[model samples]
Target: MSRKLLPDFLARAHDDRDPSPWLALWLDQSTPLPDPVKTAWLADSSSASRQYLLPFLRPLARTVIVLLQVVKVFFPRNWSHSGALHALLVWGLKRFVSPQANWLILRHFHLGSQVLAFIARNSPAPVPTSPLEPTDIDALRDDLFLKHDLNLFNFVIRLNQALRDQGLELHKPAHLDLTMLRDPDLKLEDMPHGRLNFLDLQSAIELFTPLYQLLLTDNDFWRAANSLQLDETIGIYCATLLAAPEHLVLVNNKHPLVPLSTLRAGHRLVIHGLSTEMLHALLMRFKQAQAEGGVVHTTSGDASAQ
Candidate 1:
């Protein structure tokens, strides 16, 4: 009977409340990799049994489908770390937000209670309290994340404190990725897409900010920035200085450049559309720049700073 209703079983398991991803789930659980792995979207779609079964399921997983499978197996089996459930919900949000693989989190373990709380909190329209699963949905109604999301500085400070509480971290000079300045070689496959060509401050800095002697090259800079600036301490304020090429793209809000006004007070400037020599000089300038503002002094200072 369980096998007979396996589709519904998976639908409930995924919480997608739809059946589309269920047969894949069943095949996955029941079969080994070569077989389950080979099944594509079409194989699951063509069957009436599969189609009808989808409405009975929901796609609850947000991380790699594989991780949710692990979580599902663990959660219903009375796993201790219920917070992992919340992790999966965050994973699902990540999956929906960008199908790209940039982050390196393997499990992203959250406890189960956290998961239900998150679901209760993040429903497109809030659900009325469910007494049966009170902890699952309603508790997340606490208003913390929506109000005070952390930025790079604050996140780092909090992380340091967390490490201290755990007795793992020490006060030391922190490292960050620095090799983000160089442009990748321009080829048929190497042209800047909107995501790379236009940039946001945090993301752009992360990609180019090489950690522990990570270095960016001219090619990378070309691909990532419209222009480049170097702060005295190896801090950078690269900007998207040029209008994009007309033939390849249209200027949207995501143009791969920054306004001059956004540049920080402490930087060595390289103008847009510079000659190769100018760019080379800018590279030298960045090499000469110091590392960061200074060592993270104290979280108290960070709190006041924020």
Candidate 2:
């Protein structure tokens, strides 16, 4: 079978809700098993002569074990114990223990990482690392301007208040999972390389709406500096996300009359509203800066001016 068939196969195999029919189908197709499954079967078999028989016996053994567990759970005395035990097992599997053993048995091979990749690609909602799209920005703008009847300036002020009220500091260093950036097994680089979609889009919007409002705000300082363009504003936001204090100084420094020291001290720099290009650029800059041992100092401007 094609590798493309793996996601559907695993999904059906692990459907726990109603697994009997799917398990039967999986067993029926065991004769000419998929390459991964067949290889795994042979590797685990004791003898070459028993290779063919292993395919039939393996899934049957699994089904019988599962059925026995199900039957045990049906008994009133065993129900509570079984349910509690199952819950504990799930918790342990997700948190404390590695899932490698379970994956080997469930997938008929040790392809847990591949299976996760397939599920991520086939998921109904997009992953969090995807970029922001133009429509998403437009919708956010409408929500702020039309629905809320709040101009960019007021919106930003409100966003600042909200941030302060919630005690969320925007200038803090961001934590990232580098593993999500690449797939070592497949030699795939930049794993999530696209515009934000569905769930990711919704989440990004929710998190950044306040920051977007801040960007759209028409402050006299930004207007005088002539750096109020969307791209430039977004660049500042990206810099903040990257913890690039130098870039923030470069962008915000345009308004020299507004003391840098006061702005740095009083205003909390924030990040939001990112496109694919914008996010990529930030990551590249961050890496480059780290490589060169660049030193970044916090903004020294007074916050009251912001």
Candidate 3:
């Protein structure tokens, strides 16, 4: 899509009652986007100020990252759970950010919490360190986002091992033996390298933490930030479904449907427009595909089946 026509395409995807057509376009990544078009995509997710300031924020963000590491050494278990810290952060976020920005922030935490809980229940892995089931959107952000990013990181590692042990892939389906997960034999390890690392959860959380208040009404900033959170949540869940046993399959392969690689490249297909609802609709498409025997051909070209 050309830069000149990109906004119109975004409008159609974002505004139309049925966004399936535009969704198809956004999900296709075969046609490499130009740098300008990629910038437009970023702009659609964030403010120009954010885009410009993000590069500059690197140093300060790094300092905050180191500081957080030091604080964790001293307080390990309690550093992130301070009521005052949570309250102050939430007040600042809610008071300074746009409602759209706030929604993106809250929704991803909520979904992340839900998805983690699902994985914990279904996988034969070490249980997540933090409570996976959050009570509300507020708890999702203040508790899950602030208090448990590392724990989520830990859980993904163990879950991957458990899947591997069972002769299964995270993105492919096999009937998981629930009894085996009852006393999972997996061990937590340092972060895995390459694609299995998935999203850089801690760095991503840190990247936006300092900017929440500064971004003010920049919903796009929150959208761009939360989109990373969304990527982790969606990636794991979609992978879980794709690898689901025959009876549980929701998708055959990721391909032209989800744009997993494109999301990691910083495009906003998953977080764009009516995010959560759009995800549900996408899942429904997968469900329909399952009913039709799990074969989906797309213009994006990759047609290898799971």
lDDT tens string, model 3, 1-306?
A: 333324344444354565644345555654333233333333334443344644555566656544644444544332222445456555544444333234334444444444455456545443453444433335544444434444554655667777677776444335322221111111112112232222222223344454432322233223333434433344445445545222212222234324332112222323332233223333334445556766533221111110
TM-score of each: 0.17, 0.22, 0.42
Error of 2 at 214 (Å): 25
lDDT of 1 at 173: 21
Q: Please say which candidate is ahead in TM-score: 1 or 2.
A: 2
- Give the clashing pairs for model 3: 46-220, 124-181, 172-243, 173-243
Candidate 1 at residue 259, lDDT?
33
Error of 2 at 129 (Å): 15
Angstrom error at residue 206, model 1:
27
Q: What is the TM-score ranking, best to worst? A: 3, 2, 1
In the range 165-245, model 1's lDDT, one tens digit per residue, is 666522212222233333222121211223322221122222222210112222322222322221110111111111111
Task: State the local distance difference test value for candidate 3.
Answer: 0.39
With candidate 2 superimposed using the best TM-score fit, by how many Å does residue 174's alpha carbon deviate from the native?
5.5
Every candidate's lDDT: 0.24, 0.29, 0.39
The TM-score obtained by model 2 is 0.22
Better of 1 and 2 by lDDT: 2
* Count of clashes, each model: 53, 15, 4
